[model samples]
Target: MASHRRPTHSGLTHSARVTVLSAAAATAVAALGATPAGADPQTSPERARAAVDRLFQEAEKATERFNSASERATHLREELGQVQDGVARGQERINRLREALGSLAGAQYRSGGVDPTLSLLLSSDPDTFLAQAEMLNMVTERQHSALQDLQRAQRSIGQLRTEAARDLSDLERSRAAVARHKRTVERKLAQAQRLLNSLPSEERGAFDRASRSGRGVLPAVSGDAPASSRAAAAIRAARSAVGRPYVWGANGPSGFDCSGLVQWSYAQAGVGLPRTSQAQRYAGRQVPLSEARPGDLVTYRNDASHIGMYMGNGQVVHAPYPGASVRYDPVRMMPISAVTRV
Candidate 1:
């Protein structure tokens, strides 16, 4: 049976980064799946947009994770190298001790070069010879102690060798794991880059005009500061749970894991996204980022591994991982992946 595994948002799919043509193109409509025209489009579009931008941003964030893993792998390998060196040195000490013990046992002791039983029996003073025999017993005890120490050193060297071997195996696995993560991150970055590249330069003006249609006659992107709106308000609601801690598979206004928070936020906005980041990113519309809005979903890391909600101003609301709460972050920190306007 397969153990439930934690989802790792690392990189992207090979073809994830394709571009889009127009903001109102069929892809956008398909992604949104809700018209801004009637019947709760106003409420629903906000949710859809939030989901899309979150997917893109999460995909982009994979790159940061990939880089961090790479550095960690490198450090672990280095530490493993040092451990192996210690093992080697331990072996050398054992060998030297063994040699010293062997030589001492062979040359420093004999059945009795001077205090031989034959010599003792022939001695004129057997009493004095008995004292010398007692001294020989002391020498034998010292030799035994030295031999035991040599034996102990050999055992210790053997244990160190085994430990070093295990460390090397662990280090190799870590390095491979990091490589997989890098591949994931690259995939997301490529996807984000691809989506951004999809729109023609001429479409920029059209999106800018559309973005300005909201109430109060907002200024253009050139000098406009990001403003709060219903979408932003909804995102703020999502961000409120930051620091509440993540619990996988739990969706709560109190605390949430990554997908749970995303799922709950969309639920609040009156739309439903997939329960997982990968599935969520898969269902959204292929958007030219120029069409991205404050509430759009952003996915980051590879394979739509992690996700966040867009809050404009280059920020996101996401439950990053276990022990973490939903928080706002710069969208650039993530891959800026394809914006799926829900």
Candidate 2:
């Protein structure tokens, strides 16, 4: 037989080829092990920023819900107070009526010894005759009237008590809603913060620079005159708050949310607006976006969850989001829900 030998290729021994294949398999395993589980190897900074922006928008929506619930709770508290006061006043009236009826009963019992009509007519003293006559008339007519009044007061009190109970229940539900919305806002903001933190330092710096560039700049209005004097005043008020930080549910000189900024600006012009964005959407006459003027309320998003004061020239002054401030943006930054002329 011919000399037997292990198969070999490329002038390498069979055992050496086996060793090389084993090493390549180990390298592949190591590469797979080095990557974190469920992580995308090609995630980009733009995707992260977009996610952060979405979270901020979600947080703003929750903030509006919180504001609405808080306002409802306040209204319920006032209504409950009024109902309680009415109940108390009704109870007082009922007590006085009962005392009056008791006195009338006592008078009738004391005069039970004689016929009331005969006693009154044959009385020697004029004063006693008048007193007994008046009492007899009151016993016939005023007695029935007082009883009816008492019944009415009792019914009114019962209705007020029922209202109070209903309001209390509503208030509790509103409070719970407020708390739930608050948690949602906090959670969303936290998620946004985490996304921001995950970004590279250069990207984060670029984002901060972009935010700064957008804020504190009041672009000139295009129109020579406002739609009205109140509108002019509101535009001035909004322009004055360009650099104020955005705060959820805050309507103030220092900070504001989207609708809060609009509400506060209009309030400075002696115009009252609703507290939340959705309500403010219908607070005034609706106008088309093309006809929007300075101080017109430009509501955004299909749900009208965001609002800004139009500053003419296709610009709007709005508190954009939590990390942003009162700033100027294009009127069409998001979808135009409504243009309200307040």
Candidate 3:
């Protein structure tokens, strides 16, 4: 401290460093002050419409998935019931055979408790009993036949129970899938509703009016017969439900999903089709788009989640979406996947 020692060669003391940092901080503060205040945060109408459209499309896809899973669950439940019923009948048949075998054993015991017939009846292994009976001629032909029937019944019961278990498992999985789709659809619809609500009041009213207008009127139906009798009948049936509501997972007289509409219409025509749009796409012969007739099934998008009945003049009658009725629209509304002549 007493010495007049020169500063370090670098010549940057602590005070100088602090001065430089202060200058930098001031510059940053000025830059921050230059930014605009009160910038607009609201979404534009066009942007909002696009977002809503996307959400509705997503909801429709999920609705189709829900419908398909619900249908599969129904079919699986019926099959499980049938298999379980078969198992029950087989068990009853086995009980009858056991009773018959017991009666035979009691009759043999009255004569002599050590007879071959009684021994065969008491054998624990059905296969071994049959084998021994064959080699030793220990049982009558009728008894041999009875043992074969018992073995058959046991095998049938085992197979049926196995099948029923599999169906039950499949049904559970389908139910889960249905529930998941339902949640997806609900989330999408809620988002869409929020977007719609965010719109200006006048725009919201316009949207509501546009959605409801001309919805009750049925489009003109083609009078000519379809490519086939079944197709014609299906088209007629679909025409009958043109004004019905679009209800997800419904396949009936009141309302329908896209694939449900096709499935229900085809069922009315005495032709059974698969429940999902993707499955229904391959349920019949594929026809060229130009060759599509009034009754053909029109699938849309690459995934084929949406379907409709072809009405002549380039129109398709379909359960369009959640808010839309079963209305007629141009076939070119979306990209076509296939035209199935169902």
- Which regions of candidate 3 are displaced past 4 Å? 1-43, 112-145, 213-225
Using lDDT as the measure, what is the rank order of every candidate, best first?
Answer: 2, 3, 1
**Candidate 2 per-residue C-alpha lDDT over 1-342 given as tens digits, one digit per residue, 9 for 90 to 100:** 000011112443445433433333233222324223453423323234445666778888899999999999999999999999999999999999999888878877897866679878887999989987887886779888999999999999999999999999999999999999999999988877765564445445555655644566668899546789999999999999998898998999899998888889989999988899999999989988888888889888888888898898888888888766688877777888899988
Return whichever of 1 and 3 wins on lDDT: 3
Cα RMSD (angstroms) for every candidate in the order listed = 16.2, 14.6, 18.6
Candidate 2's TM-score: 0.82
Report lDDT (CA) for all predictions: 0.54, 0.77, 0.74
The runs of at least 3 residues in candidate 2 whose Cα sits more than 4 Å from the true structure, single-residue gaps closed, are 1-43, 112-135
The whole-model C-alpha lDDT of candidate 2 against the native structure comes to 0.77
Ten contiguous residues with the weakest lDDT in model 1: 1-10
Check candidate 2 and list the clashing pairs. Answer: none
Clashing pairs for predicted structure model 3, backbone only: none
The weakest ten consecutive residues by lDDT in model 3 span 1-10
Query: Mind giving the per-residue lDDT tens digits that candidate 3 earns over 5-89?
Result: 1122234454543343333323322333321243222323334444556677788789878878888898999999899899999
Say which candidate scores most in lDDT.
2
